[model samples]
Target: MTSLSDLRRALAPQPGEAGTAGGSDRPPLVVALPEGRAASPRDLRGWETKAALAVGTSGSTGDPKVVLLSAAALVASAELTHARLGGPGTWLLALPTGHIAGVQVLVRSVVAGTEPGVMDLSTGFRASGFATAARAVLTRPGPHYTALVPTQLARLVATDGPGLAAIREFDAVLIGGAATPPSLLARARAAGVRVVTTYGMSETAGGCVYDGVPLDGVRLRLNDGRIEIAGPVLALGYQGGEPFGEWFRTGDLGRLTDGRLEVIGRADDVIISGGENVSPTEVERVLAAQPGVHEVCVVGVPDPEWGQAVAAAVVPTDPDTPPAEDDLAAAVRAAVGRCAAPKQVAYLPELPLKGPGKVDRAAVARTFG
Candidate 1:
């Protein structure tokens, strides 16, 4: 794992340096590696020379890509975030450093000139450990901030312990990396947690959209239902793909309601069942609101009659007393449509996670198979 000191040095602007655009004296790209992995500055074929950091995609949906982000982009994102969150203060590193969310925390710390308190995830995320880290961060300064995924938030909210109380003290807690269920968000806020939903990817320097609003200098548009982002916070390009033009087209589909972006599911994740397109996100949203459903993930599976069938894997609030499959299917049918109803429902102790907080749809689909 790259140390915060190393990242701060690499991201800091050199003397007499203007910006990264069209610069010959660009810093070498630093690859953010996961824990237990080693990465050194070296010449990588096809990578942009002007790039400052190379972070790997989460690979939750499919094959991962190596996203090249410039120092200018990272700084722009961090500054805009602090501006939106009132001011730059101490940050706690809860997520892994290899992912964009984790890298952004360190970048924000460097930009704010504050040392960030790190969390130990060697045995995975625990509420007790997070409470301890939160206490350590709170002792430093005012307006402390942290970022987390939906899965982590779910755990924190579910457990009524020091974790929940400690998190309520932060100025803002950013939740991203995957879709946060409406119920979960409402539950957190009702419990005094100032939860802010975020949307973006490694291609856009972690998150450029907070609480459905684009940050300063970020622009959002819908090209045939697909979300496209353009701003200084955008990455240079993927390692092997074509460089981004004025706008970087995102794979996720969304719609604008009163100038606010509301993300639908991925365009490729639409399940075509009986000649009808069923959005898994729509189904999941409806099912998530139902009683006893703690977490849920919907996916399309092969079916002889419908060509594709909707299947759901749910983690109930209580494993011993799970929700009824018929009730969950009925909720989806009422909210979405009959075609969107899950033909198969599996109750599990926990949903399978791919990267960070994202659910592994492929793994869930395999459960039905």
Candidate 2:
């Protein structure tokens, strides 16, 4: 998969290029170059008509490779999203268009014949600004939608008046990139916000599952507990020519109950300590119930005795009054089992994230290692 860092570079502007959309004050509107367009004639014109811009995954696992997504596949994904979430109207472009999720936001709006309202992504996300920008966009009087990561959703849900109110006004708000803390989602829903949890990646052109079920024309199954995907939205192949098979084998482990897919965790994330299988996602759910945790990630750290021991990294709700490490650990044991409790808990001022607000696993591992 293409490294996210290199994809970041491709989205970077040419020197001295003026910003588009709401020019000068806002970031340039990054558009996907149309298929068959190239800078020079001799630069593989035969593939130009069918080739796509490759996006690299963050090499959290190993060396990054490029993932090829056809323009047709992207539009198909957008169509699924539009159909599932009612017909699309206008979109609030608050995310970087370089990423597939953000790019889909723009494409969906365009395909629906609506010009998306742009948000400034260079500066950090703010609850107040989201309210302001969204209100400005909705002034034309049409259905509107926005996509956010968990961190952004947390901030919005915390705001009493403007932010929460603004979110409630949207047609729908998609939460993805990482798991949304249940408390955050509950609070937002209580405030009358329409929130939908999305699951998918660049290979699927963006989110193909809303809540738990696969979108229109999408197929999902578990191969020995590992998630396997096959559908119209599947990408053609990778940039370096790693071709896709009939089904895409995802590294994630999942289960299907009553036809709904539940992501358990990454297969690589499972730790066998003392001959007991421990899932970090399970630990995270317990930690999320604690009083002071704003965000958390649980991972296995190298252990001399157990081979790998459960460890947790947390961001507290209050900077001054963080939860006691022991108390949080006890809470996890109470919620789950004693064996599931985190062996070590570390406090973080903030979790390192990529794209919008997804936790950067590689960055988190770097800290403890």
Candidate 3:
């Protein structure tokens, strides 16, 4: 078994190359973490041959830790993805190179013997920038693919002109990083964007499950009301934990029925409110469908009456015009039901997302408290 120290030694760059100015000294290493789920580690010298990435969880729902993976696992994942999407295509690095999804784009390109068009992420993800970058890259491209988080996908779909136009031209867009609201996917699809919803984390080497089905060599099962994953795509294990073999236990509460996986959010994130079990992902999904709610997150706040009351944080589509809370609540209750609806709705100019394109649910919970 490859130890964490062994991985670090194998992949991290040589000593002389480590401090080079602006060199690929720190080529991103993908890591799947317990809290953040997927991340791109800054150092890769210790993992040069290590193809699988272990991402750290964002801790929006709880504490975070590292998960390990292998190169063979990554190859297995990418191969399955290529088969599912017709075949591997030229990829676009639109996201930060420090996350599993973003790193997979780079790794997939390498595996396909193709170079990906790199996008500048320092200024944050902008629809206009995406248009400009894509237009420049697509000028000399073949079949193209890009991976994006739900927040980025929502913005591109909402934007008119070049933004949405660029998205439509992509052969495929893999959306993951978090639970993508159904409404957002519908909007993107309505605008003629080919969106493939993804499920998998760093432990799975980016995304092992596309849409609802596991990729080649990947297996999914529900153990004790929680998601349990196995197969070649599974990560080695966390840094100091047991060597992961057979099945890696996932904190996510989910069930498999008829070979389809239905995610019900993290077990720790679920809130018992007013004698009813509420999954915040469900509420966020319903609220996202409401008008003017461009991005949304639901958190359970301490309530005297209901053990933990539901509250929502929203980023409206129109910055100048915000919707009324009552109307937003009404929409969610109507869509998801009053029993599962948010008790309070708060609007913000933007959701407090950490890193590029991922929502920071941890920060959202703090704001409500």
Candidate 4:
């Protein structure tokens, strides 16, 4: 495991050092490792030499790719985040260091010249453990900040214990790595949590859009319903792919409403059932609002009748008293459309997650198999 101090020293520019994407004397690429994994050197034959860090993609839909990020991009993201959240302060690391989200936490703390309180995720994230970490971070200074996935936020909110109370003390809590349910966001805000929804990926240096708005020096535009981002925060490119041009075409389908980005779903995630295109995100949104539904993942499953059928894997508020399958289907049918209603529903204690907060749709689809 690379220590936080090691990362900071590697990322920080030395005296008279030139840190740019075009710089000839670039530092060795630092690979972010997942929890419990030892660091190892990778074949860097075709990788971008100017990149400062190499973070792996979650591969929720396919095989993971290595994303190369430059020092300039990481610094820009951290500075913009601080400017957006009213200046940098102490930060807490609640995510795995292997992911871009966790790496950015360390980067921001390094930029702020502050030590971050790290959470022990070897045993997995728990509200009790988070509360303890939050207590230690809060004791340091003002304008405290932390980043988390929606799943972590949900746990803290559900616990309603010292965890939830501790979360309310932070100046900002950035939620990303997946689409957040509006109901969950509402509940967190109602409970006094300063939750800021973020939308970005490893290719964009973690998050370049905060609460639907692009960060400073970041530009966003929609092309044929697909989200395209261009800015300093953008990554150099995938390790083996061509360097990004003016715009990085994101796989997410989104639309801008009054200048704010509204992500619909993944471009490849749309389900075609009976010749009608149904967005799983829309169906999931409807199902999430239904009473007794805690978390839900809508996926397309192969069906003999409809060619493809909409299926939902739901994590109920109470495992013992899961929501009625027909009721959940009816909710989606009413809110989205009849064709969007889930034909199959599976109840679980929790939705299977890939990466940080993203639900594993492929696994959810497999549940119907």
**Per-candidate TM-score against the hidden true structure:** 0.96, 0.85, 0.83, 0.95
CA-lDDT, candidates in order = 0.87, 0.72, 0.73, 0.87
The 10 consecutive residues of candidate 3 with the worst lDDT sum are 18-27
Alpha-carbon RMSD, candidate 2: 7.8
Residues 179-286, candidate 3: write the lDDT tens digits. Answer: 888888888999999999888877777777778888877888888889988887777666656667799788899878788888988888887888888888888887
lDDT of 2 at 173: 94
Candidate 2 local Cα displacement, residue 364, angstroms:
1.9
**lDDT, model 4:** 0.87
**What is the Cα-based lDDT of residue 51 in candidate 4?**
76
Model 1 reaches what TM-score against the true structure?
0.96
Q: After superposition, which runs of candidate 2 have C-alpha atoms over 4 Å from their true positions? A: 1-49
Clash count, predicted structure 2: 6
lDDT of 4 at 172: 97
Cα deviation at 252, candidate 2, in Å, is: 0.7
Top model by lDDT, which number?
1
TM-score leaderboard ranking: 1, 4, 2, 3
